[model samples]
Target chain A: MPSRDEIFEKVKTTLVDALGLDEDEVNGSSRLKADLGAESIDFLDIVFRLEKNFGIKIPRNELFPESLFTADSGFAENGRVTDKGIAELRTRLPHADKDTIEALAKDPRIENVEDLFTVNMVVNFLTAKLNG
Target chain B: MRWFWIDRFTEFKSGSHATAIKNVTLAEEHLHDHLPGFPVMPASLMLEGMAQTGGILLGESNQFAHIVILAKVPKMTFHSWACPGDSLLYSAKLIQQSDEGGMVEVKAHVGERLVAEGEIVFAHVDDAANGGAKIDQKNFVFQILRNVMDVGKAGNGTGA
Candidate 1:
């Protein structure tokens, strides 16, 4: 199995190419949308590139869940994510910073779910899949 | 009637999923207008093709009782370029459906390589309920759809 550093390198390269960003823009702490300006369309491009580069098949709702953060998901209340929601997110997003998440917790916009995706989150997800 | 982005449906299942095909050709007028030298199919058009495939599936889900229209594309992304002579296979799976609209997951591929994938949302509008001018050519739309989709295998002889 590749070391975590090697996995991060591959994930970083894929992000740079998929989003057309400079190499320096991608790092462990960089948020995919907030820092990298990745749009809705770019998410598919990123997933596709990752699948091809890693030789894995990512289902439609695994990496970026389709219905997990919706209004009826029980994670959000009045457009804000509840404590229960954050707990659920923590499991799915192991690589995101707790401080960053807490900062955004005051008024989490359900539509801004992409904001929670950091470079490390993807690396972690891929690592888990590879190991499994 | 405007030309459809998808050529025909190779596989279709009502309210579940559908698969269609589109042949990219150099003779297309849109290709000439997209780029002077590069004769590749526009990514936007590929997205439209996905929407068309899903829209048809959604419309048929209710037997065309309402006019289904592409309302929004929450997510759409392209992984590779599709050139002329490439056979584009489009697959759409219905996620949820209601009286108002429906959601679908759509993807496009060339052989084994996935070229594009996204989610398309379509609104089912009851023109009569809204007091809007109804489409007199509903039959025309149905006819064209029938010509493309293999309604016999879909188990809905009426293309529903």
Candidate 2:
């Protein structure tokens, strides 16, 4: 298994190459959408690159699972994430930053879900997948 | 008539994807017949162009080891009409593949404007084992395809 630092390096490279972002914008705290300005299509490019580089198969619903925040999903209430949603997100996205998630939970707007996906979150996810 | 649709491949990356070009001209029979004087390219032909782009990517992914055909077009949408003097650019990406068949996504562009986009599925046929004269025609089709895609007779290399 690769070290955590090694995995982060690959993750950073993948994000930079896939999104065509400056190297400085790929830091750990940078959010995929707000900080890096990643659109929905960019997610597919990122996933494709990660799969090719790491030789892993990611389900279409895993990385940026919009289904989890759908109108009928039990995770959200009134277009906002409920306490149940927050807990589920914690379990599902082990790689995401806890601090950012907590800050967003105050309002828990549906769009805030994107804020959970930080650069470090991707690094952590890859590290866990590689090790597991 | 040949099953081929794309005129030439400008870029081919073996397994990943390909970019092909088809020049629309007033000399083509379909353009004149479809409309009285407007002479716009038919949407079906544009879909065929997209399918051809995806089909080539699917076939080359496995080194032409299987006879690939456009099995189904689950979704296709056209945004604009392509007319004479318009050069269509087809960009194809492989979504997934198996021994039996594969799926691909394609987008057609006239210059910077997107003309069409869709996902296409292809199936690998074995006419040789099924025993038909079509088996011989497969060679003809592949020959024409190889010429346009700049593929080798050996079915290896990126055709760069």
Candidate 3:
């Protein structure tokens, strides 16, 4: 099994190669949108890279916050998710529920791109698949 | 036949890399029939644009040794929607190259926002051997692509 740092580096390289970004822009905290200026198409590129690099299949809906991640039940409005914000998404899986997603999104522990919970989910999934 | 999109080759370096552009407009006939109220360029067509770009690169690079046909799209993902009046810039770089086949990484964008991305794989085939006959370069395939794309020019008489 590869170390966490090794996996992280591989993911970062995939991002850089796919997005045509410089080394400085790819870091632990770089947000796909805000920090790296990744547009929608770029997001897809990242997903493609992730899938190819890790050899894992991430559902299309799982990639977007609007599709799967949501806030609390009471916080939801008219079947819409309200923002309590996610605190730390590291523990939450890509298919996790609204409250869990909210906690992770609000969590400061996910400060950079490397800190995203989805990456961990992907890594774990890939590791398990490869090991078995 | 009118091409759904048209782009100019801004940068072309023999076989290593290439860049092109596609202008989307409401005037396109496909848009009218694609969706009634919501008209957006089809993702498959966007991929075709990438393929064309990569194909030209491969043809030029290999000196037209084999006609490059898009064999497989391992993965493709779209992040945003592209509508009328959007100019998509496509750039492709050769990743792996050989006598028989190659792969290129391609990305499309509107302004600074990325719209779609995928890796295109191409297989090299002899025009006469595969098609069971010899083919002309200018008046055959390149001419057709030029006519469809309305680019009006061929790439150094190589894309037969």
Candidate 4:
């Protein structure tokens, strides 16, 4: 199994190619959307690149869950994610930064939840997938 | 005048790869105005041809169950260009797939010359939109694009 740093380096390259960012522009703290300007389509591109690069199956919505709190998801209401939604997020996204998710937990607004998915979370997810 | 970019699928392998051909002709109106004296096939249309070739491959992989939308082109490079009378060949390989979508690596070539190559990302849109609009991917795919796929049944690649 590759070490975490090796996985992070590969993931960095993947993000740079997927989002058209410079090598220096990305780091562990870079937010996929807020910092890298990733749209919904970009996530699919990222997942494709990561899967090809790392040779692992990163299931859809496993790394970057979208519409988790949609109107009919039973996890949100009036744009606010319910407590049940937050807990489910925690379970699904265990690799995400704890502090980042906690911040969202405090706010619990559906829009703010995307901020919790950072570069570190990707590294963590890959590390666990490869090393687990 | 029809929006069909690819003439026919030259090859296909469900959930694997497919190749199609496009016969660029000066008779097409767009080429006449794109560059008055130089009636070369636009790289954009070539890219679209690649997308259609790749899209059909992905759609067939799932038996056309999901509406495969070309979501993004993360990487594309034009090594050369095609012109009137050139039979451009587009080869697409399914690189990755999930319930959400699939990715394909596509390349355009004429004879032995590489015209263009790119990676296209496709997303499977749900049947119904939030506001009640709906599209049946299988039906729509068959209506406009099924002829090219039929080539797979009679020609080079595996059965559809």
Candidate 5:
């Protein structure tokens, strides 16, 4: 299995190719959407690239479940994620920064949930996926 | 002008690849209006031909059960120009496919000289379940290329 840094480098290269980002622009903390300016369609392209690069099969909805973030999912109330939502997100995004998710819950504006999808989050996800 | 860009499919393999040819003609009205004297076949139209070649391949993979639209163009590059009297051959290969969408890597060539190369993204819409509301269910793409597809089928040894 590749080391976490090795995996991160591959992930970073994939993001740079997929999203047309400069290498310096991406890092452990950069957000996929907010910081890196990835649109929803780019998610599909990124997943494809990841699968090809890692030779892994990722089933639909395994990562970046955009539908879950919608207001109608009962995951959030008044655009803020509720405790129930946070719990659900914990279950859903096990590889994400749990502390960040928890911290955001204290000031959980619904949009902030999207912030959990930073560069490190993907590296973490791949680390677990490959090591396991 | 007729939205159908490619004249016909020269080669087609279900769920894999397809090659279609378009014969650029000086008689095409757009060429007359596009610059009047130097009637070069626009790269944009050649890109459409590439998409059509790939789109039909994708749509037929699912038997055209869903509405497939050219959803995105992530990469495209033109290396040479195609002009009147030139035959543009568009070859498309399926790169990836999932339930919701598929991607194809396509190239447009004028007899060994590469004109353009790119990747295309297509989305499958289950109109009935997704509430497309007022989408044309007949699929304009299939409607236009129906005859050409028949020709391809006949040439494929279907004999009908």
Candidate 6:
């Protein structure tokens, strides 16, 4: 199994490839919508890329907001943002929460973003199934 | 272009049935991206076409009382790859129906050659609620399909 940092790096890379963003723009702190300018269709394409890259099905409802978030909520009305939004972002990370996701994002042991998202998603899914 | 369909229904008691055709053309964009020179229709889209045909069949069977949406494609198999300039035919028959969901068996063929076959499961849904609903047979579904297939006529049969 890959480390969380590696998964994060992979996820970052996938976001870059799927969304067609520059490499420098992707990081643990990078906001998906605002900084990336990803739209609804782009978000779905990102999910498809993640699923194909990791060989796991990420449910659509889990990745996108139930409804579009407004600018008043701190997410740019157009859907961009900062590291603070990372907390809410965890809820959409396939099956992750704030603390575990934050640890993975911050973990120096991780090397790539792909492994981070994959590991986090798999572990979180497994843990949820085991506990639930 | 080629078309593939499962079965041909000449006549039915209550439910509705229909046929589908797909024209495989060199002009299709996916042909280039799927492979360098070898082009095959994406299986997912083929399944979608089958589901669309099936949905129409079920809707017509129940007289359009409910709209049909594909809830799942649990199992699918591709016996042969359809290439450009081939015509594919798909025929579907309603296996079962109820207030919840229904199943249909669809087959695809290129001329007399069997290309692919699979079973599609769908739910009868209300256009308003966008979910499952009970079907009413006396409405529009059966009437539409009967007219399209031209069943009950002596000489009109599925023409391969």
Judged by DockQ cut-offs, is candidate 1 incorrect, acceptable, medium or high? incorrect
Candidate-wise lDDT, in order: 0.77, 0.78, 0.63, 0.86, 0.85, 0.57
Docking band of candidate 5: acceptable
Model 6 stretches with alpha carbons more than 4 Å out = A1-132, B1-16, B127-160
TM-score of each: 0.50, 0.54, 0.49, 0.91, 0.90, 0.41
**What's the distance in Å from true for residue B74, model 2?**
23
Q: Model 4 over residues A9-118: C-alpha lDDT tens digits?
A: 99999999999999999999999999999997888889889989988887767888885776777888788888889899989889989998788888988889889879
TM-score of B-chain for each predicted structure, in order? 0.84, 0.83, 0.80, 0.87, 0.87, 0.68
Ranking according to TM-score, highest score first: 4, 5, 2, 1, 3, 6
Candidate 2, after superposition: displacement of residue B39 in Å?
18
Q: Is candidate 4 or candidate 5 better by DockQ?
A: 4
- Model 2 misplaced regions, further than 4 Å: B1-52, B55-160
Q: Positional deviation of B89 in candidate 5, in angstroms?
A: 0.6
Q: Write the per-residue lDDT of candidate 5 for residues A35-126, one digit (tens) a residue.
A: 99998888888887788789897778787877775656788888788888888899999988887887888888988887998889889889
Native A-B contacts reproduced, model 5: 0.06
Every candidate's fraction of true contacts kept comes to: 0.00, 0.00, 0.00, 0.94, 0.06, 0.00
> Can you write out model 6's per-residue Cα lDDT over B68-156, one digit (the tens) per residue?
66765545788887888887787777765655456677887789988778767666456433333544533534233334444334545
Report lDDT (Cα) of residue B42, candidate 4.
91
- Tens-place lDDT per residue, model 6, A11-69, is 77777765667778776544455556654445444554556566665453554453323
| Candidate 4 lDDT score relative to the true structure | 0.86
lDDT of 2 by residue, A1-132 (tens): 899888888888888866667777788888899999887656656766677678897776576665587655789988789998999888887777888788877879888898888888888888878898
Query: After superposing candidate 1, which stretches have Cα over 4 Å from the reference?
Result: A1-132, B132-147, B150-160
| Deviation of model 1 at A96, angstroms | 32
Of 2 and 4, the candidate ranking higher by lDDT: 4
DockQ of each: 0.03, 0.02, 0.02, 0.80, 0.48, 0.02
> Against the true structure, what is every candidate's RMSD?
9.6, 11.9, 15.8, 3.4, 2.8, 12.0
